[model samples]
Target: MSIADRVRVHSVETLSDNHYTLRRATFDFRRNDGRWQRQVRESFDRGDAAAILLFDPDRRTVVLVRQFRFPAFSNGHDALLLEVPAGMLDAAAPAARIRTEVEEETGFRVSGVEPVFQAFSSPGAVTERVHCFVGRYRPADRHGPGGGHAAEGEDIEVLEPSIEDALAMLRDGGIRDSKTIMLLQHAALHLFPGAVATPGK
Candidate 1:
């Protein structure tokens, strides 16, 4: 379609009773060939969120975390999962949230955070827009691998795997988290290609 102008829309929540978001709408638009067209988009009620896929350039590695993902387990995954350093936005800007996530999850003081892309985690029923980014780290920063494991039910283990090793893990089905996979793919294409080396540390 050439363009679409949103008309009036409304929502009715049933399943959630109070939390399910909905959008019913009509659009005013035209097709490329001059025919009128309409676009209907549905959305859920959710605030913004952020996810950070961390890479240690100086060590040529990316920090990965493993945790008990109840949802995935109930969905039939054997183990919980392999995932990137990620978290909710909490009303913080994507960049700021990412930096905080890196520190809290990996103990790598966020040095340089580069906006990678924004992703829609799911479109079927969730209104989650993931702001993805990359944070650079070095050997000096790995004084320890830190993360959260509080009563809120967060138990995490941080890992710094070589870029080559990380790729191998990706190929072997180890890096399965959707967001983590995307981050690794980005690093493979842009950060590490023929060789892997730490840059600063």
Candidate 2:
């Protein structure tokens, strides 16, 4: 049996010379109630991927970034956030893409990056898939605490804390990125027996 959602291509409009707007035709997926519902969603219609950087089993620490987030601010809190190295996978190779994001976002060289998993970031509203991985980080070898300026208005801070400390933050509700949380908790349980979980940054 195949478990693929039925999708219909309703209409397509050109967003720009380089991009397109996909207006998907509405056909309500029948629920168990057997009622026909209709809904419409607009897809940006771009072929893009996402990237995540996992600082390897550093003697005991993970490299993270603290930055200003507009979303959290609008909701109720300040705009600053602690997050793992991450960005869109705009490159050819996912691992290499994440490695580059790590260095650019946090100024760390992620050596032996291993692909752990790939999953949907927001399947309901967006078609964004995140390539999650563990990148080996070396402090002495990596050049500096690195960051960049973007048109998107981003300010990032680099941080390195022991895994134990990161775990404490997780338990205390400091970490937030869902993908990073899943990766770090897995690492704490399997990579370091006694090490605690903590970083979303």
Best prediction by lDDT: 1
Write candidate 2's Cα lDDT for 1-201 as tens digits: 552454334454443435434445444554556664566665554444544545546477777678887767788766467777777665467776777777777767656777777878667755667777776666675776676466666678777777777777778767776776777776787667767444443
Query: lDDT per residue, candidate 1, 1-201, as tens digits?
Result: 522342323433333336434554445455556676566655565666787777766678788888889878888888858888888887888888887777777777866789889888787756788888887777677655566747768878888788887777777776678888888888888877674433432
Off by over 4 Å in 1: 1-8, 17-46, 142-145, 195-201
After TM-score superposition, the amount by which residue 8's alpha carbon in candidate 1 deviates from its true location, in angstroms, is: 4.3
Candidate 1's displacement at residue 11, Å, is 3.4
Which 10 successive residues of model 1 have the least lDDT summed? Answer: 2-11
TM-score of each model, in listed order = 0.78, 0.77
The models' CA-based lDDT, in order, is 0.74, 0.66
Task: State in Å the error of residue 124, model 2.
Answer: 1.7
Model 2 RMSD, rounded to 1 decimal: 4.0
lDDT of 2: 0.66
